[model samples]
Target chain A: MARIDLDHIRHSYLRNPVKDSDFALKEVHQSFDDGAAYALLGPSGCGKTSLLNIISGLLQPSRGRLLFDGEDVTALSPEQRNIAQVFQFPVIYDTMTVYDNSAFPLRNRGFSEVDVDRRVRETLEMIDLGDRANRKARGLTADQKQKISLGRGLVRSDVNAILFDEPLTVIDPHMKWVLRSQLKQLHKRFGYTMVYVTHDQTEALTFADTVVVMYEGEIVQIGTPSELFERPSHTFVGYFIGSPGMNLLPVELDGASARLGSRVIALPGAMKSAGAAKTELGIRPEYVRLGREGLPVAIRAVEDIGRHKIVRATLEGRELAAIVPEHGEIPAEPRVTFDPKGINIYADSWRQELVA
Target chain B: MERTRNNKARFLVLPVLLLVAFSAIIPLMTVVNYSVQDTFGNNVFFWAGLDWFDELLHSPRFWQALARNLVFSGIILAIEVPLGILIALNMPKAGWGVPACLVLMALPLLIPWNVVGMIWQVFGRVDIGLLGKTLSLLGIDYNYVQDPVDARITIIVMDVWHWTSLVVLLCYAGLVSIPDAYYRAAKIDGASRWSVFRYIQLPKMHRVLLIAVLLRFMDSFMIYTEPFVVTGGGPGNETTFLSIDLVKMAVGQFDLGPAAAMSLVYFLIVMLLSWVFYTVMTNYGRES
Candidate 1:
């Protein structure tokens, strides 16, 4: 395993890339430590795949240095970089047996016949495809073919990292879970540096040690899953990471007190003085207390999702969602209160760190 | 109700059946009548009863022409399929170059078959033609009009130049249909370029390759116009394929009974070979 570093990586398809808008990936400077599972997570067209391709050496950055184990590998091809990739769809040799498809790279590199067969068999067992070893790949189901594609990547042990570009999109949901668990376990056992790119939050959150949330060709935040959920560094992260994400209410701040519409709520510290302080308060739905006291709200709807109820309401012209226990009764007149410590203040879509 | 619906469907197909029978039955009956009977002008006929079929089957000319047809078709298919694939692989996948390349390839296919023959005939002559003149200037003796080897080379090269574009177009269509995600996956697998082509591109191109082989085989096997125009089955019948030999018997000799028998044999051979080609290819496709 090697520590992969991206230093000020920016790319543009045009020959003369002049400005920021011309770049597909804008100024991404980050390092993935050795043996760490990192996910580049974002919506489509947000440059997550571009960053992944850059790290894999499939694409060259217009300006940047890519370091693998402190050695500059920016100009290397994918072959020279020694990275493995699993694509979105299965790409197996249909005329060959599943064993040959999985053993192709090893055979191409002129490995001994015994070593190739041993590695191919081990990978087949890892993917639970041992029984289908001799079957022609053309006759297998789509999911089985995809497992062979995955095994082809995993069969090669001498690689800097294995990159996945939404490899589970074609898989059935049940198989997706099974394969994801298998991948996580395999990573644990092998400890290979893995970089996965996906637009699915659940997959990114479940798979990676560090989740890099991206928006509009820029990396917005990089943190653990819990840190992203509780303290989203950007407004897009607050809106993207959770179902019925965080609520942001426009507020006026005056040192230890924040005014939301006509109601005043206490804060923990003095607000930073900046020109035109357009502050907003962010709070997760799980922390919002609904009771018979506090600010009155008009309940719009309630969704019962087996174990929990999501109460959708309007508080002083701002829509909010609050999660409560399914058995909890809604008061005749509902009032919501925010947890002071849980509330995050933002100015211009950036979080404002509080001084203790 | 279901029975009535089935009856209605059968009724709808009646006119098509009538049209097919009208086109096929009359000519087939004429050929059969000619094959079985002896005629001596003046619209007088006598029952010969399989005499012509037996004589035609025993003829050495018929067997030799059949052999020549098979060899020509084999050479054409072998050359065209691989060359087409190589050119198509090198073609640009997108942008203005794609349409430009497509138009250039389609130009040869659009030209009339007889015109292709005439063009090559004039283009390959020793006196005024560029190829023949260049060869003579280089002190090499190349006369397709007189030598069987030269005639065969000219015919094979002409066929390759004219019909290889079809295979390239078919293979290109197959290549363009593949999604980019598959390439991305191969890249991630750390697969070499050869593996990517062998595993991804070649397998995906199987259907088109089948079509290319079948089309080229049938067309090359039945070829008469181009070689007839260029070589005219000359240089001592070296390039007289089955079609040319049948036409010679039917039209040149005016021996209707033997010619009719030969035509039937020719038709059967083409149909049988085409059926074999189609069945084998589709069965292989299914098995895979």
Candidate 2:
């Protein structure tokens, strides 16, 4: 419904942030396209919630301009900006029935009784709480209360954006899945500009069309799920995305070959040192090939995880993990090789494009 | 967990039972014994049966004191509860002002009961005190010692000044415990100031407010020290309460049987009122 633009936004809880480290959110300049589902993904204390709050206008940035649909709304409140946010915990008016709870936002915006009633009923049905329209919100379970929360946001279809701040945290696992799928369906049906903030990789990967990965107080990468898996822009992204995460190994680069310990391995592509002080090779565990060839590794353990086996090994004193298909043979002497497509080179922890 | 069925473990409570007998049971039993008998000088006693209770129940003086107690408690609750809630709502929620406001609200409650009575008694003197002299100069004839209305007003104001802080402190605690998300969500939902208070803040403060109401009710009903010191149940017993009347009956008149009977009735009244109130409030909360 609205394209949100963050122009060099920076925030700090302190009155006077003397240094950059004092800021909770470092300078960030990005624009989210209208009608696109984006997830702000990061670990705890990584400033994801701060960024979400900024978007919702619940928090004003210490510095920068926020534009909604090209209109500067930096000084506007959440109500003025017409933003709806679902918090980590379900918030409901304990005295109001589910129908009235969902109708609150609509009624606040001066909608007529006929319109409010129609929209509330439609949203309640969408959230699978249609039968509970007459029940007071106090005695509802966590998930049902969360659905009522979702219904309030959904009732008003013309809002600028709907934001979610770990809204499924109190829900059970099975309920989380149901609510997430319902949210996806709503997003697709309405084309709402949704920004979900979470530390969960699976949720971000599946729910978002574009995932914005953040670390410390800055965004590390913004890309699609496939793009992030194949081409990570920062070492943090590589370490944060996958199940076992990408294995990083220190290497010394020379011409087109990198030396690990006393052995030299041919690089898949050319390297540009550019006076770099540190270099490492990054690769996902799914692409790590273990066979009877290439560099020898000391296999420490093999864990059978149903569909596949995870080979835990030590290669040149560096720990590594490789996934093998079910029933795959583990050679008497195991050797590991990197898939050329999975190879990523980092210069000072920033991923560099390997020239083919 | 495995259940431990040790019969000998029950004997560990012997010390507590002995302590209770010394602290609560023995004194209550003595009062009961006095209530059922006629006592003379030098401990000469005779069986009175239910005669003391029947006489006290029929007396208009005893019924008037009970009515006065109920009226005082009702006025105190009506004034203090709303005033405390309003002050708490207006108080600053953060920064240096929080501690300052809390300490200021707590000052009235920290004074000794008799000291509060003494302070107000002197402070309301028509010739020498600031309030009384100022009221006299303003052409208002406010003589607490001579006028019953003025005397009752002084007692009620004194009680309000002393005890409203307990309510404010409890409600403030309740207000702070509410998570920040609820406010943020309310704002996003475009709730007006009145709606936010009615829906969010009031519901959150429900339990603490119940405690505040019950405590203020009981404390105001059993009030004795301050009013007793200020009015001495004077101005024709205008400020006399149940506790004050019972004290006068036992200590001033030395009528042990009638005083003990009155004490038993007063205890039952307080218990019955508190229980009924708690049950009604809790049941109302549970229904929705």
Candidate 3:
């Protein structure tokens, strides 16, 4: 129930780190407002876990101040911070009964037995484990154990935030969907400031109100899911966030037009002084229109993914994917055209703002 | 679906069958045969039919030895299990200290049992041994040769020294296999140090601790070498455990019938107790 501010946080595992690449988390200066749901999304080894740990105080950053509701908590331990974290693997007390497992946090905090029992019963009911209150946690299934792990946090009434580190990795596919929606419902019900870390785009997009995309130890872009889909600030976000991710074609910019080999595509607005090398035009496969009247292209493969077809084609010696409807016609002399609104101009792998 | 009853694959077990027969079954059956008969030397044998078993059971000396064996095992377990867990808990979890600690802990287990006994035997002598001389100098009556209490204590200490490393090693194996996430989660739960050990660590160590307890129990109950070498069942037969007394009857007194009867009873006792321990511990470790 507090806004967490990770102020200029950077961490390196080495005792004495020298170079910038030595850091696991490069400067992370972000704030999660009170009661906001955020997902730190990135590939493996991208410092998503490091940032999450910094928020939870499990890891003390090598250089930065962490604040909870404007109070400096950088020096505080996780216990002192009163944060709850669910790890990738379920961490349950196997010797305890389901009731005691959920009641562990409150018991540790010296809550009265009656209070603990009442709170634990409520939590067990919430997690659908009410009947298993007296049963030992020994033989529960993976999803059930993970629910206990989640219930450990909800038993407490004073935790600042609940941090999840890929908590659904070991769960079955159907259980994953169930637990995910359960987490969303919990977030809405409790209004706890939750920060979820995952590499799955669907999990990130659906679970969090704000998705912070990271790449190579830095925050590449932080935006709403649709905003990220439409306007990717970094090329990594453009490539990493979508399923047949955004296609990047090397282009030369002239006035408001981008020339890929010989053909030119008009831009929505003129690029200002975005003088840079290695310029590419980024476009989503969903917006790339393939018809009989635009630039000539050789179609390589068409994948029917039930609802939509992904048309993989080579344009100007570069491969690109265009999404077509399931029953859409593929013209014999197929040519491709970019939807004017979907065109994003990048310089040095960073999107440039157009001078409107 | 019907399972094919192929008798051809049944013969494949013959080598193991012959190996067990030659190694264990023959000796065991011979002892059983001798227990049911009287031997008057020169291969002269007569049907005894449980007479030896009845006499051995009625003998106070045999009962005393069995009692001594149980007491020794109980003391060893009570002392070693906790002590081994303490040492393993204190051992360094990482860095060069880990290897150094492990090597030092494993040193005692590498020594042969009789060698360990011989070392402690000399080491506890009142006149020249370091421990006994030091105790005598400290105004203590510390002689294993004439004092039954001192002899019993010496053997117990020697066994602890020799085998507590085994318990430590097994418990250490159990402790390290636990993922770091458990500790982290416990910390976030605001668990006290004792709570962490009780809930997280002790439960995780259940499987290996089962092995350590069963091993230490069986080994201590069947203990013969170390005490035999150190105290030699002296001080008025006080330290004479079941195995030592059985060996004395068979090898020293040359009483084959009584020895074989005692051997069968001893083997069954060990087997029954080990089975009980295994079943109880495995059920306790049913979490995973």
Candidate 4:
């Protein structure tokens, strides 16, 4: 295991990268602790895969220091970095048997036949593909082939880190869940430094110990799943991490209170400064209460999702989603209230710290 | 309504079947008829009852020509497949260069086969051709017209130049179809360049390679125009493949009975070999 550090990493395809927009990956400076399961979560083209590629030495950053275990490794190749990666689609040798596919890296590195067999067998058992060991990979289904790809990465124990780039996209929903659980178990058992990239919030939250939410070529926040859900550092994070996502309402700040349209809502603490340009109040759907009290809302639609009902309504002429329990009643005159602790104030799309 | 719809669908296949019958079945029937009979100059014919086939089977010329055809096809396949793959691998993956490279590759394939032979015939001459002059300047004696070895080498090289681009284009299509995720996966696995080529690129290119091999083999086996143009089946039959021999017997010599028999045998050989190639490759693909 190794603590991988990225110090001021930035990359651009063009020869002269002058401005922020020119870069595929904006400046990122962070460290992943040894044995930590980290996720680089973002929508497509948000530089998550680029960051992962940089770490794996498939790409070199234009300007940055990549340190592995406090030693400079920016110039190292992927082989030198010792990283295992499973792709979005399976990348197995179709002509080779499952056993050979899984044992490829060990054999390439000149491991003894006994050692190769032992490791390959253990990985096959771990992936529950032991019975198909002798079968050629070309005949396997997509999911099974992907498992072989995963097994190939996992068979080598000497690797410093394992990276997964949305490796379950092709898997069926039920199989995806099963594989996700299996991956989680394998991570627990092995304690290898793992970095997974995914656009799916559920996969990111479920797989990683620390979820690194990215937006537009930059890392917005890196925190535990609960921290991200409860206190998102950026409005994008708040909007991205939830199913219906968080509602950001334009607001005028006044010290410990903010006015949303015609109503004044009390803030938990004082705002340090009203920031430039865009100012809004962000809150998750779960934290927004809907009843016969508080600010008036014009209900547009109600979605009954079995366990909970999501009320889609217009608040001060802006659409907002609020979650209510299945048994909760809808009032004839519907109103909403934001939990003071759950409310977050954003200025210029950045979170503003609250002053006690 | 159901009966009418079924009748309409059955009618749809009639024209296609008729087209196949006219184009393929008719020629095949003619060849079969010729193979079984002998004809004199005044349009009078006699049933030979496989005598021509027996003669062809026992002839040393037939065996030698078949051997030459096999060797030529084998050589062409050996040179083309890997060379094509290498060129495709080295070409620019993206940008303005891609279309330019594609156009350059397609130029040779667009030229007529006889024209290609004429171009090489002129290009390989000792007096006016740049290649001959350059070879002479480099202190080498090279003459396709007078030397059998030189004729064979020139023909093989000419075929490679003309047809290898097709293989390259096919392999390039296969290469470009590979998603970026596969390369990323290979990098993460710390796969060496050779491993990546072996495990990912080669397996993904299996379907294209099979097509290339089949096309190159059939074309090389049936090659007659280019060698006939350059060497004229010449320098004492050293470069005379089966097609050249068959053409000489049928057209130059006008021995229709033996020629028809040879054509049938030749057609059977190509059909049997093609079927064998297709069956073996497809079955291997399935088993893998």
- The numbered model that scores best in lDDT is 3
Give the Cα lDDT of each candidate: 0.88, 0.91, 0.92, 0.89
Tell me which residue pairs clash in candidate 2: none
Residue A122 of model 3, lDDT score: 91
What TM-score would each prediction reach against the true structure? 0.93, 0.98, 0.97, 0.93
Q: What proportion of the real contacts between chains A and B does each prediction keep?
A: 0.59, 0.85, 0.90, 0.62
Q: For each candidate, give the TM-score of chain B.
A: 0.94, 0.97, 0.96, 0.95
The residue pairs that clash in candidate 1, if any, are A84-B188, A85-B188, A85-B189, A87-B185
Would you give me the overall lDDT of model 1?
Answer: 0.88
As for candidate 1, its interface RMSD to one decimal place is 2.6
Q: Model 3, range B144-223, lDDT digits (tens) per residue?
A: 99999999999989989989999999999999999999999988899999998999889888888999999999999999
Off by over 4 Å in 3: B1-6, B285-288
Backbone clash pairs in model 3 (N, Cα, C under 3 Å; residues 3+ apart or in different chains), count = 0
Scored against the native two-chain complex, candidate 2 gets a DockQ of 0.80
* Clash statistics: count for each candidate: 4, 0, 0, 0
What lDDT tens digits, residue by residue, belong to model 2 across residues B95-212? 9999999999999998999999999998899999888999999999999999999999999999999999999999999999989998998899999998889999998999999999
Q: After superposition, how far is residue A77 of candidate 2 from its true place, in Å?
A: 1.2
